[model samples]
Target: MPQARRKTPFSGKAKKQQLQSKKQNKTLLMSTSSGTTSYDVVSVNYQPTRGRGGRDTNRYALKFYRETEEELKIKKEEALKELIPVPEKDLEVNPVDYFPADVSFPKRPPWDFNMTPAQLDAQEQRYFKNYIDSLQASEHWKKMSYFELNLETWRQLWRVLEMCDILLLIVDVRYAGMMFPPSLYSYIQAQKKDMILVLNKIDLVPSSVVAGWKQYLTTAYPALRVLYFTSCPAYNLRGVTSDKAGQSNEDFCETILEKADTSFYTHERYKSGVLSIGCVGQPNVGKSSLLNALMGRCVVSVSKTPGHTKHFQTIYLTPQVRLCDCPGLVFPSTVPRPIQILMGSYPIAQLREPYTTIRYLSERLDMPKLLRIEHPEGDDTWSPRDICDGWAKKKGYLTAKAARLDTYRAANSLLRMALDGRICLWLRPPGFAEHRDKYESCEEIKYIRWVQALTSDQEEQKSDVLTSESDDDRHSDDSDADDDSTDDSETAAIANKFAALAGDD
Candidate 1:
């Protein structure tokens, strides 16, 4: 007590610093405003635009780490004004309403019922603990989550997550955030496991946009690493062989492999240095394609169909690393069905009442222009039915009896078009803006740029050599011309000598 009476000089400063750190950790970077960040203004007036497109309602705002107390209060007031309270009984939105009426919603068993404590094996026991921990940690899971996984699906996922040292979370580059499950992310972190986020369909999005996503994802999940890849054009190169072209399917496939394989993964559990990486993602995220490319061959089944892998399978790549492919799990979606449909989780072929999804797509993308529907009359706005009928007629899809356009076929075709990357449905980063000039990338993207530079240097060298060879060909032609001229003079001299001899005779 006597010793404690002598207060440490720096104790107060240290405690203050500790408190600030804790406070800062809780604050999330929300949004930034270029217009006026001035906190002095007591009132915030948002003048709604009254022009074409109805006031630019889709304008995006940037989120910052923190805002002033006054700004926070203003935001709260605005939010409160906009928010209309609903009865507690009517709070829940039925997910089935978002989907087609024909489609039966996948039933979810009670979370605890799936794996009862008495029925749980040793492995199941571990997964149960992880699940409980994840639920406790994530408030979003508690409120919004609905597990679509059956017992078999849960068991497969549990096994994959349990066996693998690293998880390769593949997400469609267009809708990475939408597809990525927050519960799984929280679960992985809770288990202290490593995850490498693979932004799979990179070709569909611009490199700039990929960089933006990379930066944003890295910021959102600090524990996970990120990478970008696309196997479509690369994996599906028609007949281009290594002998014919230096950059063949083989080479492009290697680049794709390097993109994911090059991600840093290490764990102390693998004392033998052989690590298992589990590939997990929503169906149609190119999980099989990615695994095939990484393995340098099609070890797993590659298909256009989602949920192609019905069960979990492991293929050994090398002594150093192996890939564990689990069935493509569709996690509970809080998002609307249009988003789910667009994400490729829904079977495009079996889509009934595709009008809603068609409308959603039509609004975002200029469907009339894209589908080249020159109407009977000059009309800008077209209904889903109109667009479908127009597309059906253009594509030669007609009903047998009425000879009317088969709108169902046309709708399916349009959905496939978006999926096939003919018509892009790309999404930008959450923090994306048209006005922001400075492009920023994450550490992983910077690493990718470094790898790209190396590959580009090789191409540049080959081009330089070709240029030098062309220059040498020009020099050789000049020397040949000089030699021809010398030979002509010798021939002329010999002819003159012969003429003089003939005159003497």
Candidate 2:
């Protein structure tokens, strides 16, 4: 401070040289302090843009500062635009269009009882590899929905097919044609196994539709026997009384056994006299439910999830008759992915783009009317997105982050309802609408109507009994109340007499 030194302007190059010298001196001091003559020099040149790039934390902070909430929202919208499925032109497509004439499902590779477990596995692997390769070579493979890829699941099906004398192919009545694969029928025919085609969940559709489907399917394949089954038969189709439902289920089992008895028995397993009936179907098509209904108990676990049964399980219906259930397998088909999802072939939780599925269902069915969702824009026009938004609003579904309407959840819930048959989308067989009159007067319809009348009569009688019992209870209650009042008055007079005695004393 006493002697002012000459202040010199430091040039950038000079400053750099000075810093380098200082760093070198520091390194020398460190080497001296360690008392090592030969010390390795470590050079750390932080070229952020070279080799493994560094994170620009400061740049990101600056960018975040520049971006307002509106801008962030716009960016989010732009990102989400990539996930949205492009709308397709709605066309009048036939259900059979999904199954082309040339395409066939993979059959179990020929394995006699002679093959060892290892040999059988090797042969199956070879067959499945060839099947998948061939499918991939064709154009249809790209369009095919997800099928059973696990060898273990297919192995279960093969076991059931090999062991059972009678093959029961259960299909949901809503999409019976799609569910029933011709290749499966062909395989059954080749095996000489008696196959009974069961249109399960008949309660979802009208009786006329059921009869029509039965007629159409039986006519299509003369050897194929078609029977309608419902685990929880609706009151309109069958009486609500458990006794009546149990009787109907028992009769159903009896009819199947009788059919099995009449069928030409040729399998070695058939000689046991214990009828082995194997149930097979695509996933979530009521295979498990049908077995439980037939046994009049939950013999097998039932789930809405596709492929819930992981292995083939055998349950004895009677000492003479047994039912074998195979894990639900998804047979390869050209069915649209959206349609497959709608059919409950795909798991809802694993859905990548559920908006497309919602769109497909909305196009085919009056989803707005079915769900009773009002238009979000207060207009008649309702797109799938609009439908989802409206439903979210009505359901009060919101996101936790910013409390925005949760359209994804809304769409997913709607799909679940449709899959569970709460929102029915029954597909009529070909020529069903034209010959509706014939189907209405069909025997199946008559039988269902008769059952409905019987159920009504039973319900009326039950109500009468309940009313009479309630009336008796009311009378008894009144008599008890009168007795309590009489006892209270007698006690009160006794107390008054005691009080007068005390006053005299």
Candidate 3:
């Protein structure tokens, strides 16, 4: 530091050279306005003068144009105006008339008390959980919600649609017009949003009718792109034996994998990232079973009973394809008593008179004409009792007292028929005549007979087993020769009956 302080470049020529070098390194900024330009020099000065501590000092200045004081004030005022306070409103007071006289309402009776206390509790918990779960699923869609379309539900749905990327509109081919409202479809289209229309329960109708249904849908919903799926494909277990179960399983897996791969490969959405595929349908429509079939595994639980699946579960098919499985949506308070009975949610065993509901539905839906059963000679209109008696006599549903028709049992049988879709009440295709031949022919008599035979065989087998067990118990208690002989004879007769049924097959 002392050596530096000796004034190494005090000469005027050296000082002038140093100043010239500094000037060359400095920046010259230019500003132009109103067809005129002004120049300003920004300098970085190095001062060699030593301070009290013997340190060199340096200074830098950047020069540019300055606005007038009045202009600066105006600009600041404008900014302040732009930031004006957002207005706030006071909360409204609740009206006295809005309060209920009794704040607490009585709890509804338990629908499943036939089960054990613990079982009832568990079922109730599950039902409540499912109800809550259904509500929560509405979060997935902006414009569509599970509950009945009311002011509150509509508002919530609108909020959901506001944020949704795609809409999956599920239309039940059976109840097409009633299930999907025109306003809802119009609203979806107005948004210019992507939509995938799923024609659910294709298995319920004949494959031939599907073409006409598709055509009808296209005409009805020209904007919507439709996709077809049967919830339950006739489970094809051909060539699969007990010994080859493992091989058959592998083959099934490979088949599903190949189909999935092909679908993925051909799908434009898979190639270019797009919206997901969401599955939605009415109760017991086989949405869950279809998912399991498509996935080639038991990913979703499938039950013969309706309303088993009560939540929207999302499964990832690929990086781009996510399948959203939704709960079976039931229109609140709109489901009729007969429909509930058919769904197995209402137990037939618990009813005081099971046939009452069945008879009501039968007469209302005209089941006699549908079945093509001619009334006794001159009878114009058949009563439920007459139909039940006739059906019982024909089906051999007779009482032990005599060969007379057991109307009680006949009612049960008729209920089973209606539930199984063997007898169609309120059967009509969309945009067609009420009693069209195609709709009439939807009843597969052969398939119904097959199902009936199978059901009858199962019942016979159960009865035979019970009778054999009772006979065995009686023989175990008795050592008498006659009793033993009678038991043996009874067992042989049961075996013969089962053998005859098996031989028929």
Candidate 4:
């Protein structure tokens, strides 16, 4: 009942296209009957070869089976798709091995020019040029930001770089990006040293915020590894004691705990060991606190003042590892000095005109609302000075001479509030979610309070703004509907209302 299929020869058009494609390579390049080379023609003053033309003409007429041009092209495209090239795939995107897209160093610092200055200078010029050119060509260059070079202070940092095997770049979680110096990152990388970004004050922000920052940093710097820490551990919190981390820190804010033990596996630098890990960061970023946290006691002096540690020292962690504790330095930044002062990088007291900074802070933070200062003139508007004056009058901060409210004293108090985290102005690393993850599932006693606060802030910010139209609709609904009508399922509304009341109590 079955009929056998008959084989059919390829179409002539396909066969002809195939032969033409192969004519140059698989098919020999035929010559005309004369067999004259180009060299021979050149000797005779441009005599043409007739033999090449005749042989080619005969070869074109010969029949040959070959792959079609379209078929070959399709095969080539398929091959290319399978073999698409990309930058090397990094399997271990972890805290481990990675080749450096290393920031090459300045040939020689001006202070320490030992050899031919001209030679080093020339090399430096060339290296910087190449660095810029390469960056210009790369599509990823848009993601990078520029830095204000503070060459002088980094001298100490440079010395520290030479001495350490692993560099711990400590950053305060509240101001992680501000404290993280791209220049220092370049410098450490230039020295071919291993660096870990240690995010201190972990108890300040939520776990999801921490996770997002970790993810963001890891994305930007593929090799960057992160570890979270807090100087004020759950056990160390003074006066207010809760045998858990999640409840107490948020309840009492992240203030220092008096005379309490705190410990972590993080090491400090200096001394000869199998590995030398150094602690470095902007001042008040908890470099000294980090050391104390690791030691479980106050081995190193800790202060709110920046650069409290003035000298290089060592804290022996173990026989295998040593910590190099270097004094924190105020690195170069293009960010305004007032912002730096607000960031606690520069001393707030060392300023001449603080009015500009006060103005800057007021504009963003709704200072009047925060300070509960109202204008005496009975207007909605108030200048920074006016707000300061109102605050001064409220607090009875009188200038002794004129008996007027002391505006300067009020300003200082505002700055103190910001520094102490009362005002709650903070910078999160980029790509952080607007809606922080509900970390209620995280039952870690030490982390619960922060989670609660983070979630509460997010939820409050997410509430829908009631417009005039929406308010009218709500009123109409109230009049039209039954008084005991269910609002979002009866059980959920009751539970939510009850929870809110309990929280207030």
TM-score of each: 0.56, 0.65, 0.41, 0.53
- Tell me the TM-score of model 1: 0.56
What are the lDDT figures for the candidates, one per model?
0.52, 0.59, 0.41, 0.48
Candidate 3 global CA lDDT score: 0.41
What are the runs in model 4 whose C-alpha is more than 4 Å off?
1-153, 233-272, 433-505
Model 1 stretches with alpha carbons more than 4 Å out: 1-118, 121-147, 233-268, 376-378, 434-436, 440-505
lDDT of 2 by residue, 239-341 (tens): 2233332233434443332121111223575656888888898878888666655654444555666655656676777889888777777777877666677
lDDT (Cα, tens digit) per residue for candidate 3, span 380-495: 65655666665555445567687666777767766655544444332233434433465325544233223223233433343211122122222122223122233343331222
Model 3 regions lying over 4 Å from their true place: 1-172, 183-192, 203-212, 231-274, 332-380, 396-409, 429-431, 434-505
Q: Candidate 1: give the clashing pairs.
A: 29-64, 29-65, 30-63, 30-64, 31-62, 31-63, 31-64, 32-62
Please give, for residues 66-122, the per-residue lDDT of candidate 4 as tens digits: 223564465434321211222212111221111113322232333333546456534
C-alpha-based local distance difference test score of model 1: 0.52
TM-score of 4: 0.53
Q: Quick one: best lDDT, which candidate?
A: 2
Per-residue lDDT for 162 in model 1? Answer: 66
Error of 3 at 92 (Å): 50
